[model samples]
Target: MSQGDAQIDFYPATQAPIFRENWPRMRSHAIVPRSKEGWIDPVISEWSLEGAAWEDFHPHAEYNYVLEGELHISVDGEEVVLQVGDSATVPAGKLGRYWAPKFARMLTVYGPNPDGEESTDFKYEEL
Candidate 1:
């Protein structure tokens, strides 16, 4: 079989076997490797933020889906609150910031870095 034909498999997000005991923590499940060429990278990240403050993620394109709980995202001066099952996309070169008022988890898939770089440090004033 071709290298590209190799399939990745399923696994628990946490060390514990029971869902209730392990589902609360943040974790990442790699669906595809970065070496794979495509329009964007696909990844499943489970985030559990316990009252996290605002954090900036500079300029880069991103798409995220809220699997559980809620998240507050600020992109290009626009603020958006996301809940379970909610999804949004941030354009490339646009300033992106995210915050979680309480504990929450999300799945994010992003890319197509036109700049051909991972991330950039851009300065922005508080809105």
Candidate 2:
């Protein structure tokens, strides 16, 4: 997919790649490829973590929607616990930590990506 392609993309919720240690041992799969569409830059992915935690700073705003289990996010000096069907947005540049006590599945969206393909670089970091 590329800019001006203007084609619909369908990625099944259950369609996830092999679990990889992308975030401090947490697993994630990139659902949307890196691309530029006009002035918009977006990243989409499915993530799951169990008994683990990870933290990072995003240069772009991030929206996380819980799909199953629960997710606990600590940002801006507060702990935001999101259960199934819950959603939350972390402001750009905020240090956010995500913790899954037992297990959690989520749909994540990061947008207005200021760094293009590098916007979601955290997913590939060795950390």
Candidate 3:
């Protein structure tokens, strides 16, 4: 490898830093860490859930692809069930709720960081 040369980055995504830390029913394996230099995370993660649910909104967009089982998602109260090999995109600033019954395995992508703006944490509003 030489200075100024582009290098391929490899992640041992299936090993170490194992999932299911605090959120018992939910597990995540991060492919890219959240960015401190953007309004979006620029992150990719593999996630699994069993009988779990969560809700939030972000200033940036979010995408979810189901690899196995099913993922239930609601964007602004419109519900969609993502079956195996299905995907969904939640536009920027919309409230989203994600969950799974039985089990689900999926990949999640966040943001393009188009403007390179500072990121803000997830938000929520009372129903």
Q: After superposing candidate 2, which stretches have Cα over 4 Å from the reference? A: 1-6, 12-25, 35-41, 117-127
lDDT by residue (65-105, candidate 2, tens digit) is 99999898988789999999999999887778888888888
Clashes per model (N, Cα, C within 3 A): 0, 0, 0
Each model's lDDT: 0.57, 0.74, 0.74
- For every candidate in turn, the CA RMSD to the true structure comes to 7.3, 5.7, 4.8
The TM-score measured for candidate 1 stands at 0.61
Reference-based lDDT, residue 25, model 1: 33
Q: After superposition, which runs of candidate 3 have C-alpha atoms over 4 Å from their true positions? A: 1-6, 15-22, 39-41, 114-127
Per-candidate TM vs. native?
Answer: 0.61, 0.73, 0.76
User: Candidate 3: global Cα-lDDT?
Assistant: 0.74
Over the stretch 11-83, how does candidate 1's per-residue lDDT look in tens digits? 5455222113332333334443343333344444444444553344534567878877887788768988998
Candidate 1 regions with alpha-carbon error over 4 angstroms: 1-44, 114-116, 122-127
Q: After superposition, how far is residue 56 of candidate 2 from its true place, in Å?
A: 0.7
